[model samples]
Target: MSRKPMLPDGLSSYLAERWRGIGLSLVIVVATIWLGVTGQLGLYIHPRYFIFTTVMAVLGLVFVVSSFVYRTPSSGEPVSARRRAVALSGSALLLVIAAVTVLALPPATLTSATATQREVNSGGLDGAAAAEDAAALVGTGDYERLSVKEWVSLLAQSDDPALYADKTANVTGFVLPDAADPDNVFYVARFVVTCCAVDAQPIGVPVYQPGWKATYDTDDWVQVTGTFVSNPSARSADALAVLPTTVEPVDQPSDPYVY
Candidate 1:
């Protein structure tokens, strides 16, 4: 009886490696292009790098296609069957995981849950760039138009109530509770994305409102129109907190994060 020929262990391993490379490459390329096309790339990366990332993804895809077209001959060396099986199974598992994580999952931004993990305005805002931006806006005398980033920078410089008392703040962000006093203090905050989402930093202006959680829960997007006042809550670390005249629920903006 005649039997069908099978690939030698070495050739099988070689093909497995090629498939693994191609699968992972495809997952990354597809995810990048899909995010770009859908305008959801910003959820993961800064808006400035969007074009560069898309271009690189396109180049990667071209190379992947070229690799597929240009078939490679395998080395006819012997390999242990046990080793070959383990390698093949491992490659398949990796490919499946990459595909699921990069392609299958829905895109999302950092939430207040994540913001709580990091100290509010911990870093990246007290630096020159943010100070420069805030300085420009401060000159403009349009305090109402200032973003969470600018406000955070301004607060870091000086939390003196006199400096901000008359400067009305009309800021929008997700609600994140004050760790010191969750009852009477919370922040109107947004994640400041540096290079990418992994390096995002939460920065915000504190709001002093007793029974705030009864009206608005954590992570809810809201527009807070108020003026700064000395924080009433002794437990809260902030020197000044927004005494909100109105805290209205708002939809999460198209670009919820600050760059």
Candidate 2:
């Protein structure tokens, strides 16, 4: 008859005994890889980090596979009693529960309400770049491609409305009514993600039109197309607001965040 192999003791035994933690770690690794492969990772993080996620997932799988080589402790084995008790604590189980919960839940993007609560920068362009960009765009007559961030920068840097006058803009963003602005004006905002959702910055363009509050509900995504006109009467005296010729409701983009 073949003899049974002896089990590991002490810390080695403790590590091997927590197989559930290893398994849950694998579940999380798989979930992350799936998100990255399906391009759903963009919902939580910037696209640039997807490659790093893939690398980490691969390393995790290797580590989990290697863990199986460790001999599990037998029930009758002489383990350090106090250390064994600590190894089987609630903290480890709670971590497994949290990991499983995250894996089970559907991914969701931050909403317009989140944008309202966050620090919003209409424009953060430096004075020099803002001036240069404002000058370069003066005669270009192109406006349809301008993002909410670009518009915000232009608004902050250029005090003159002529720099924006006769310029048309077509911007897509979710609607968030600026409670402080007139009923005609609402904010079209996009979350600018650097690394992940935690550091996302909300940047918006103010849309000016009467009765917009009644027409568009908060969080409704829309494509606002119109001329960029100076609205001195606007809440932000410096902003050259979009005078929307057509505010059409649109479906949200799959990757809604602006990188």
Top lDDT prediction, candidate number: 1
Candidate 2: which stretches are off by over 4 Å? 1-17, 72-100, 122-140, 232-238
Candidate 1 has its poorest 10 consecutive residues by lDDT at 2-11
- The lDDT of each candidate is 0.88, 0.73
Per residue, candidate 2 scores C-alpha lDDT tens digits across 1-259 of 9653344455545564766677777777888888887789998888899899889998998888877687564566766645555665654676677676777677888887677776566323344654466456544766676677667766766648786676787889998766567476777888888788887877778888878777888889999998777764446543567888899999999878886
What TM-score does model 2 achieve against the real structure? 0.76
lDDT of 1 by residue, 1-259 (tens): 9653377655676766588888789889988999999999999998989999999999999999888788787766666666677777888999999989888888877998788789987875547888899889889899888888888888888878789868999999999999999999999999988789998989888999999999999999999999999999999989999999999999999899897
What is residue 79's positional error in candidate 2, in angstroms? 8.7
Model 1 vs. true fold: TM: 0.88
CA RMSD of each candidate after superposition: 2.6, 5.4
